[model samples]
Target chain A: EAGVAQSPRYKIIEKRQSVAFWCNPISGHATLYWYQQILGQGPKLLIQFQNNGVVDDSQLPKDRFSAERLKGVDSTLKIQPAKLEDSAVYLCASELSGANVLTFGAGSRLTVL
Target chain B: AQSVAQPEDQVNVAEGNPLTVKCTYSVSGNPYLFWYVQYPNRGLQFLLKYITGDNLVKGSYGFEAEFNKSQTSFHLKKPSALVSDSALYFCAVRAAPGGRRALTFGSGTRLQVQP
Candidate 1:
């Protein structure tokens, strides 16, 4: 019963540069999600995936942010040409069932200069 | 249109004393409410949830939340606070049973427990 896994506990990027974060949800979990948590703010949903297909990504910045869960297992969230405001923590979560509480990863902290 | 609000940005309490963190929400139909605790540099951990049945739902770490339908509020509570209870608390909500899967979270309330 391992928890959701995420990589690169911390990252630093310059404005206009690109950065990517990865996530591995718990085994047997059917849903995966990516959320952005800015300092002093709640985590905002960026994208959600049910299996290998996307369930919702309406809040995602299409022009700069993109995410995908290939084969319905691993996920990657990318931000192209990052902005200073993009400095925040990226969290990955998994849900065994939509009716249950989510299990979250440690998160990847991004500091954009 | 589901949303949660944590009016207080921070709350302070002394060890061995009771503690309460307030939260309110708005959503259509039945609401699935939840409380989560986040330690610094870590992700959120589920504390409790209110789906149905009892209005007072207990959760991990000696935490509990009372769900009031009329008030549309789910406030976290602990009978006796501990210094380890200090952390960031978030209130979240979503439509229960056959609704959006995404959770709407509050800005969060920082709990500081003084020993």
Candidate 2:
């Protein structure tokens, strides 16, 4: 019955620095997702995973961003050489199966200087 | 490509009055529509969804949305607004073509309810 959990609710880093965000989804959930929400904008899908396998990541910035759900229960999203444009809130969500409703975490707000 | 549009950037309504936030979508085939709400500094929460049923769908927090296939619109509505209803609302859609499940979201609409 626990909700999705995320670590480091807020983060600050300099441009070109690296940052990582972690997410622990609801127990028994089979699908997980990562999204980025810029100020005044809706959350954009970054990646999605069904269990330990990726379902979609077409929108992700392959050159700078990467994510993994090794055991399928927890996930980590990383951004290397962060840019000012990368300043946004990163949200983590989980669902019971494909196309099911999502339950989200508080999200990690990143500020890149 | 599937996409959603929220025409209004913000809407202000007095408490106890009716409220509406407009949204339109573009997709290839039948669409799975959704509405979500976000509090400041928080993640998005599902309000309701329209898959297949009546044109009017009711959701949490006394909210409802009318799905119009002819207009390709799904506008969020509430008969009586409350101050606690103030938040950012987003409309989203997913095309059923090829069985893709990813959602395309609108920029968002900010709702302000005055007492």
Candidate 3:
């Protein structure tokens, strides 16, 4: 069984520039999530998708961040006009419906200079 | 609203010694709690979860957590520590009743087991 897969393990961008991170969850997983982990902090859920339909995005900054799951399999998180504080690791996790176990990806670390 | 707290920023223990990492949570009604460990430059690995029935739950890597409803705490423990066990540990809780399934996590605690 393969774990969740994420791409571009590392990224560096300038402030105000736009950046995007990609995530491909485990096959057959019904729930996908995007999280932001700042240094010394636990990952915070940025958004969640249940089969291509957003389940939660209350913490997402609408003005600068957006995410979507295509066909409920792969997902992408984008940040436009990035801020220095946005520098963090973007983690992707997936779980089956009604299951509590969550499988995570290695994450993409973003450095905004 | 749901939240978890790891009061300690770091915990140190010698190899072969018993270890404990503290965690507390705040949520309305029943709480679904979890523990995850992250090694350097690695994604979080699920350690264990407490949904119902048992206050003591054992998980991967010889880890266990005891859910104390009265104290609203779930502390991770291991009988014998190993150098390889050094990592960042996070505690998380599911959202409130009828809310999204997204988890709210603690700031994280770094555990260092010395050899």
Best by TM-score: 1
Q: Which stretches of candidate 3 lie over 4 Å from their true place?
A: B95-100
Candidate 1 is graded, for docking, as: medium
CA lDDT, every model vs. true structure: 0.92, 0.92, 0.92
Worst 10 residues of 2 chain A by lDDT: A94-103
Model 2 spans with C-alpha error above 4 angstroms: B97-100
Worst window of 10 by summed lDDT in candidate 3 chain B: B95-104
Worst 10 residues of 1 chain B by lDDT: B95-104
Evaluate fnat for each of the predicted models and list the values in order. Answer: 0.64, 0.57, 0.80
Looking at model 1, how many pairs of residues clash?
A: 0
**Model 1 Cα lDDT, one tens digit per residue, A10-99:** 999899999999999999888898999999899999998999999989999999999998899999999998999999999999988655
Q: Model 3 Cα displacement at A55 (Å)?
A: 1.0
| lDDT for each residue of candidate 2 in A1-113, tens digit (9 for 90 to 100) | 99999988999999999999999999999888899999988889999998888989999999999999999899999999899999999999998865547889999999999
**Two-chain complex of model 3, DockQ on C-alpha atoms against the true structure:** 0.69
lDDT of 2 by residue, B1-115 (tens): 8899999999999999999999999998898899999998778999999888799999999999999999999999999999999999999998763233667789999999999
The TM-score of candidate 1 is: 0.98
* Number of clashing pairs per prediction, in order: 0, 0, 0
Instruction: Candidate 1: list runs displaced more than 4 Å.
Output: B98-100
TM-score of 3: 0.97
Q: In candidate 1, which residue pairs clash?
A: none
Q: Write the per-residue lDDT of candidate 3 for residues B19-97, one digit (tens) a residue.
A: 9999999987899999999999999999999988889999999999999999999999999999999999999998434
